[model samples]
Target: MGGDQAPQMVVAGLRQAQKLHPNISFLLYGQEKLLSKLIPSDDPLRAITQIRHTDEVVTSETTVSTALRSLKKSSMRLAIQAVADGEAQGVVSAGNTGAYMALSKLTLRAIEGIDRPAIAALLPTVRGLCVVLDLGANVEATTENLVQFAFMGSLFARYVLGIEKPSVGLLNVGVEELKGHDKLKMAQLVLKNNPLIENFYGFIEGDDIAFGKTDVVVTDGFTGNIALKAIEGTAKLLSNFLKQEIQKSFLSKVGALLAKSAFSTVKHRLDPHRYNGAPFLGLKGIAVKSHGGTSAYGFSSAINVAVHLIENKVNERLAKDISLLSQHLVQEMENLSLAIEKPTPIKG
Candidate 1:
């Protein structure tokens, strides 16, 4: 009920998800009359799903503060509450991203040892998939926050992307040690020295993301959000260019038809719908936020992400890892501070 298409697309996505994970059950929260009609009696999802009616919904235009202050009984909040109360394993929504993140954080709270939860998603890359984090979760991040993102992102890649020893990289202006600001430079030092974090790949530039230079790319939300939109725009530009070229002449049209299968493969590989879910990592309970304008197929993909996180027990492992690495993180940060405070004088 929270998405652009509302209950219609939501139910359709549930149907697709049900086909993939037949054993999983669903608790739909929306106008019962409308939702009940979407799923026919013969639908398999009907047997496993139970609707919890609610007239409330968080609109795309609703301010985060207003949603938090007044929309307590909205479907989004109720679903997250279900997770917090232990009635559901996870919650997925294609609603207002700010509101969704806020409610999720307020209800489920942050996992112990995690000061802030980051938004992480898998993006298609040349090597396969790369886990990128802080994709608009935090506009600014401290050195400590970046280090934690690297750790959590690496684990996400290991568990979800199936990379045994995921290589982590800090997104920066250049791969050089002195290129980025203080936070990135400090994070690089911390990651490099911390024996707990394996395969620290120093810094990776914007182009490195598409090259899949590392399995996990960590950055503050300000940079990550811009990078994500730019990549998306480039993909669209290329796709449109290809289509235009194919229709320019009879010869080109014939060529495109002959290579239609290859074109289909390329299009499928680049489809944003394939990488729809972005999880709020480091949270106490699982909460996945899908793109609001996506189709049912995309929504189903988000549901798959939530299910995978639950199945992998990602939070449990992350909790233990954070505990073991906290002491090392503090020590590295202290070393960085001291180096900054008392720099050795250079003799010309």
Candidate 2:
């Protein structure tokens, strides 16, 4: 009910998702009269689907405060509430991103050791796919926050993308160690010493993202959000250029026709719809955010993401990892204190 097309896109996407996961039950939270019309009475999904009937919706212009304080009955709020109440395994929405994030945090809360939750999503790269985090969830991140994001992103890649041992990289102005700010440098140092993250690939520049330098890329929300938008714009630019050039001449048109199959393969590989879900990582409960303007297919992909995370037990694994890392750090500090107290042999 919160998307650009409201119940229409939501219902259509559910239909697509239902086909993929026939065993999964769906809970639709929106205007029942409107949503019911979209799904036929004889539809197979009707057997497993249930509508809660929510008239209120968090619109694009809805303030996060308003959504949290006043719109208790909104679809977005109720869906998240369902997750918190243990009625649903996960909740997916293409609604107001800010409102969604705020509501999710207020209800589900962050994981035990997580200072803040980060938004993580898959990006198509030359090597296959990369999980990038802090995608507008927090504008600024501390050294500790960046380190946590790296660990979370790594776990996400391993569990969701099926990478056995994912490599982690901190986003920076340059690949050099001394290039970034104090926080980045400190985060890199911490990651280097942390044994849990086996493959800390130091720092990676903007271009390395497309090349897939590492399976997981970590950055502050301010930088990650801008970088994501820039990459998206560039993809659009290149696609338009290819289409314009293909239609520019009769010879080009003939060439394009001959390579239609090859073109189709490339399009499928680079389609944004294939990577539509952006899960708010570090949260206690699962919540996936889809692009509001995405097609039904794209929304379905987002739903699949939520289902995949649940199957893999990502949140459970992440919590354990965080706990172990914290204990390791405490032990390291104790060892350092003891070493400092035991003075070195004089002139040895």
Number of the predicted model whose TM-score against the real structure is largest: 1
lDDT, candidate 2, equals 0.88
Residue range 27-93, candidate 1, lDDT tens digits: 8898888887887677778899988998888999989998899987899999999999999999999
Per-candidate TM-score against the hidden true structure = 0.96, 0.93
User: 1-348, model 2: which lDDT tens digit per residue?
Assistant: 357876788788888998999888888898888777877679887877898898888999999999999998999999999999999999999999999999999999999988899999899999999999999999999877898899899999988999988999999886343577867766776788789999999889999999999999999999999999999999999989999999999999999999999999988998999999999999999999999988899999999999989999999999888988777656654554475469721111
The residue pairs found clashing in candidate 2 are: none
Superposition TM-score, candidate 2 onto the true structure:
0.93
Off by over 4 Å in 2: 175-178, 329-348
